[model samples]
Target chain A: MLKIDNLSVKYQDGNQVLRGLSLSIENGETVGLIGANGAGKSTLLMTLVGILLPLEGTIEIDGLLQDKKNLRELRERIGVVFQNPDDQLFMSSVYDDIAFGLRNYGMSEENIKHKIDYIMKELGVEKLQNMSSHKLSGGEKRIIAIATILVMEPSVIVFDEPSSFLDPKTRRRLIHLLRNVPMTKLIATHDLDMALELCDRVIVLKDGQVYAQGNAKDILTNQKLLEEAGLELPFCLQRIEL
Target chain B: MSEIKKSINRISNLEELTYRDTVIHRLPPVIKLLMTVIFLVTVISFGSEQVSGLFPFLLYPVLLMTVAEIPMRPLLTRLLIALPFTLFAGLSNMFFSKEAAMMLGGIIITKGMLVFVSILIKTILSVMSVLILVSTTSMNDLLYAMLYLHIPTIIVLQIMMTFRYLSVLAGEISVMYHAYILRAPREKGIKLIDMGPFLGQLIIRSFDRADRIYHAMKCRGFEGGVIFSEHKKVRTTHWLGLMIVSVVLLILRFVNLSELIGQLVIG
Candidate 1:
């Protein structure tokens, strides 16, 4: 469904973040991208959405290349949930935020309203339909952020740090939601346990390169590989088997 | 901390009031916006010495507020914040112009005082009318009205994004203020020496936030232009309300209602 070939991204001041990294994900697969801070996970996500032009290499989404000419169409097929819900939820009300993409696509108001109602109800945020973004709690904001993406009905969804700042119950709910979503999901997170619970495959990133890639359970259990990538084993797997 | 919280609450309270169901709230946003513009123009067009002429204009806001079922306290509080600048301008007129314009029971009313009062009345009436429009109409509706009026899409988007960012920026500033106070409990506010770094940090943080927001917007397929759904047609009642209110405003603008009432009562 998605392909990246020798992708290398750099900042304006000559700081290379992602260097010659290449990977591909098949349709209907869940992949987790895990690494320490500044692992280029965000850069990769932004590049895929055409927000940041990669320095070298090509990104193809459903056979459409990521470029200025194809950005609008490419973005239509990909939904992104930003790390900070504040950034994603820019509309005055939750309903508007969820309907933003639909409006951009020129959907009828009736259709937009129907989709928004269904999405908000599915996320159990119906009561917050009219609430302002800033007034919501962290968990509520996160759920609303997800709804904003989900309402777009994109074929692929990219999530950046979806579990951060959420309480345990809300975290569990998120895990459940991510596990059940049938679309192609590329989640970048530090929550190893969540990745283990939701991702079918795991890709470990270290210093702008793919250090390791394998099945989610196997990659997660490799303590030596994780430590080398500046990560740690999930808490549940931290102890040695007696 | 309390001050910041109060200001945040003040904004949300005003926003909440817009959702209340009432006749005025149900009026089309374009109509309310047009009424506000017409009211402001009429209030400002009066002669600088015609304070009594402006007195009748207060009815517009008062009637709208009553019908809208909006409380006056929040609107008045916001108006108070805007008064000082106008008050200062009026005070300058008091000091500069001293020609006597009227007499009442041996007391002189200078032309300066008349102008001052007129300015004050104009400020109050204009601000209150806008407050009524805002309190009764949601920001979403107002933006739609702007789009319906054929305002440029970029300008409308700028307004919407700026308003959304205002509270976000304010919340950030509030947190920074609390952190400052917590560290230097002996100080009232950031010291003048600290203002450089204090404000610098805010700008940097705001820039970073804006960058992320731009990326988020782009990811949602925002491509410079915004599309709005078709607006509802302006109805008969809207036309009638506009005509009646406008005619009354014109008559009051030309003929002082307060003087006519006094003449009839005291004759």
Candidate 2:
């Protein structure tokens, strides 16, 4: 389980982004975090991964509290795919980027190679193993970024803007892949259709606070709430009676 | 825009050449690195007027390029980028030391000109050797060799990260430049007064990107140091290759093969 209690984040510039927000995500659940620009969606995800320390709150991943002493342990159980694939895929080659986490955790070479190959094959990116990360197409890079995170086998995976720059075909493929992954996922995205299709629950954030939380169908179809939260109802459900 | 694109292409081209399958490329990075160091040391140890002694050192890069199937054009182009500084240093010798050192037919070769030629030769030999090493050895193997040689992990990590981020920084700058140009199309170049904020924005963006990269790395379990999982053992052939290259370089350093050949042909 992942839990955030009264989380408040203050940036170095004295901007308090997240304000007393508390939420809990159960294991094996796919939750969609929908919010407008600067709605603290990215900040929340960053805080979850311990990249941004909250001013007053506690974040626990799989029962391990987020702290300097428990950072390694907490990070080991959670993985984050940043909004920009370029930031996530830093190593020269795709194979090295995927192997980075395994090596850091001191996995044997043989096992690391095996895991990387398996993950790449699973993601249908086996041919990109030797290709430079920066040379890959945007879609290919997004897949490789996910592959890098998935290979680590983190229990809880967080994605910020998972479908931001993908084409229709690639977006469909990514949605399919995300649906099949059997782990806890918190996806922050602007693609309402994707959030509606993949997530079982939705948490709407308005100005760094949870405006509403309920079933995916309920929140996605609520045009009034979504409009107030700086979002809109999904096109498919725009005409459907709620 | 084209300049940025060309630079990004250069970075990729250098990396792509290292992936070629060849005998030189197959040589272990440690052995190749050691040979490069020895070649550079031998070339620079010659007297400033010993241009003939440095001629044999050319064979190292020539043999490697041919055997490794590397195109000489790119290497030469890169060498040109490093020549201006050396040329200035060589020009000073020409101006300051004008005493006659040798006779070519009826014309006198001044000591300064001879030394200048030697400097140019030394520069070519040293730069080409280093370029050949990089072209043939992948960055991964190079870092591993550095670690094997007991180089500080921090320095190796710096090199690795800098190389990895070069293209990214280039791309970011290209975007910023394009944005500036779009808003000010009539301007030929950024004004001197505007350069301060223009560069300041680039630096700020780069630092923000670096912070995010560090966070991403930390999320993937990067804890202060990098661990390479692949370990390659030195083979017997690598040792033999290293020995042969070292012996040939040492002989060239001490013996003037050019002078010997000239004497045999003309005396």
RMSD to the true structure for each prediction, in A, is: 2.4, 2.6
Q: lDDT for each of the candidates? A: 0.88, 0.89
Classify candidate 1 by CAPRI docking class. Answer: medium
Q: Candidate 1 residues B109-205, lDDT tens each?
A: 9999998999898889888988888898878788889988889888998887788788778877888899998999999888999999999999998
**Which pairs clash inside model 2?**
none
- Candidate 1, residues A65-138: lDDT per residue as tens digits? 88889899999999999988989987767777888888888888899989988888877789998777778999
TM-score of 1: 0.93
Report the number of the highest-lDDT candidate: 2
lDDT of 2 by residue, A19-91 (tens): 9999999999999999999999999998888888989989988888899778788888999999999898887
Model 1 DockQ vs. reference: 0.60
- Residue pairs whose backbone atoms clash in candidate 1: none
Q: State residue A9's C-alpha deviation in candidate 2, in Å.
A: 2.9
Could you give the DockQ of candidate 2? 0.67
- Expressed as tens digits, the lDDT of each residue in B81-159 for candidate 2 is 9999899999999999999998999999999999999999899988998999999887888998999999999999889
